[model samples]
Target: MNQVSSSNASLLGATFMLGAGITFAIINVITPIVTWQMGVPSTAVVFWQYVIATVFALPLIWRIGFGALKTRHPVAHEVRAFLSALGVQFFAFGFASGVPVWQMVALSMTGPFFIIAGATIFLGERLTVQRLGATIAGFAGALLVSQIGSEQFTWASILPVLAAACWGTVSVITKYLTRDEAPESLTLYMLVLITPNHFLIGLILGIAVAILPAGALPASLATGFDFMLPGGDALVLILLLGLVTAAAQYFLSLAYKVADATYLQPFDDLKLPLNIIAGWLVLGQVPGILFWPGVLLIIGASLFIMRQDRGRLPTGRSPIPETA
Candidate 1:
């Protein structure tokens, strides 16, 4: 790719990433509320969301055919799907557990740090001093936002952090796969793999809820495992969840296609503020005093990492080597 074409691609990728961020923020806000309102289990919600995404993606797969799906890295796709499923399940659990949207969003800022760590460990990327410092500061911020010393801290608060870690692993694997795989193929295979996994998990959980004694299971899991059929507004929201998720996933794949993960990762920070606004408008929730400062630290850490990378790379391209 020439400089001009690369610049254009980067611009397009950034736009796609921005769109992904926006749609995902909406998803973050709406999915939990929809799950709670409909009394659907988290795994069930994930299953439907992916089922919808797979349905929407089938046309593209039909156009591209089976050849596009061929890859030497089937194992990689499976691993990515597993990690992504774990991340999605954890996130859904966090939201359904009554953790505030903004707080969940804030903790999710830890994702980039985990991404950096994954890149370093798995991708053979070097960890610079600035990156190390930024990662530490980012975690410190997360700890502050967690308010562990306060009575408000609960195990539920940790779910988003686990989600972030899983997502970060997915991001690293994605960066690796983008070396040879088309983003569409990667996205398609992931949905194909995980949709069934989620359904099976949901089914098992539903059965457990039916068989187990009332006090046997944790309250959160019990509530999350309560399977209910959607109706009325809940039905509409369920359908929208699938469509919105598919769109978001597509945009995200497009973003990774044209740009390195490092180049696009910073744009993810936009979701926090977006989620904050969405939380206030849609859910009437507001962050407490410590939330703002913690968010700032997280954002600052991401910027610092970006700046360090910027100084090392050429003006228009990433220094990170692409694998063949």
Candidate 2:
């Protein structure tokens, strides 16, 4: 592609990614509400979302043919799928546990720092001073969100941080696979592998809840396994959750195809502010005063990293090293 075309494609990819981030933020806000209304466990909700996403992607799989499923890096795909599933579980647990939307979003910002560190340590990418500074600032923001030395500090709050770390690992592995794999294939295989895993776990959790006494299971598991059949509006919202999540995943895959992870990482912070707006508009929940400063630091740090990384690569081209 010519320079103009490349730039346009990158712009398009960035736009899609921003839209995906917004969609994800919306999902983050709504999932808890739906779970509360239906009294269903987080695992059940996650299982259904993945099933719907898998069904939605069936057409793409058919068009691409069975050949798209063939990959020499099966083990890598397996590992990535596992991490992705674990990340989803953590996110669901965190949200269902009643972590505030803004706080959850802030904690999730730790992913970019994890991505930078993973890229440097695992993928042999350079650790620039700007990236190091950004990572430090990002963690500082997370600490602020955690409200250390305050009454809001709870062990349950750590789930989103762990989720962010898992996602960061997934991001680096994804960058590695993208060197030789199609984005569609990576996404398809991940869904194909993780969907069943989530479904099985949900089933197990449901059975455990049915057979075991309430106090026997861990509180998080107990809360996440509190399944109830949805009716009316709750059912509709659950279906929408699946659809939105699927589309967001596809957009993210496309974004990574057009740009390096570093270039795209900053935009992930968009979800924080988006979540804040969503909470205010939909739930009448405004963040505490400390949230504003922390969010601004996170965004400002991300922008600093983005500015430092730009112009190092040509427009619309990925910075990932080519593979054999």
TM-score of each: 0.83, 0.83
Which tens-of-lDDT digit does each residue in 154-184 have in candidate 1? 8889988998898778878877887777755
Q: What do the candidate models score in CA lDDT, each in turn?
A: 0.74, 0.72
Q: Pick the candidate with the highest lDDT.
A: 1
lDDT of 2 by residue, 1-324 (tens): 899987987787778779877878778877878754455677777777777777886765576577677898999988887777778877877777877777877777677688788988998989987789888988888788878678887776888889888877887888788788876577567757878767656777778878888898766577544345466876787788888877776677667667665567667567667788887788677777777777777777767766776665322322111000
- lDDT agreement of model 2 with the native: 0.72
- Give the C-alpha miss distance for residue 270 in model 1, angstroms: 1.4
Question: Which residue ranges in model 2 land beyond 4 Å of their true spot?
Answer: 2-7, 126-130, 203-220, 223-229, 254-267, 306-324
Error of 1 at 308 (Å): 3.6
In TM-score terms, which candidate is top? Answer: 1
RMSD values, in order shown: 4.8, 4.9
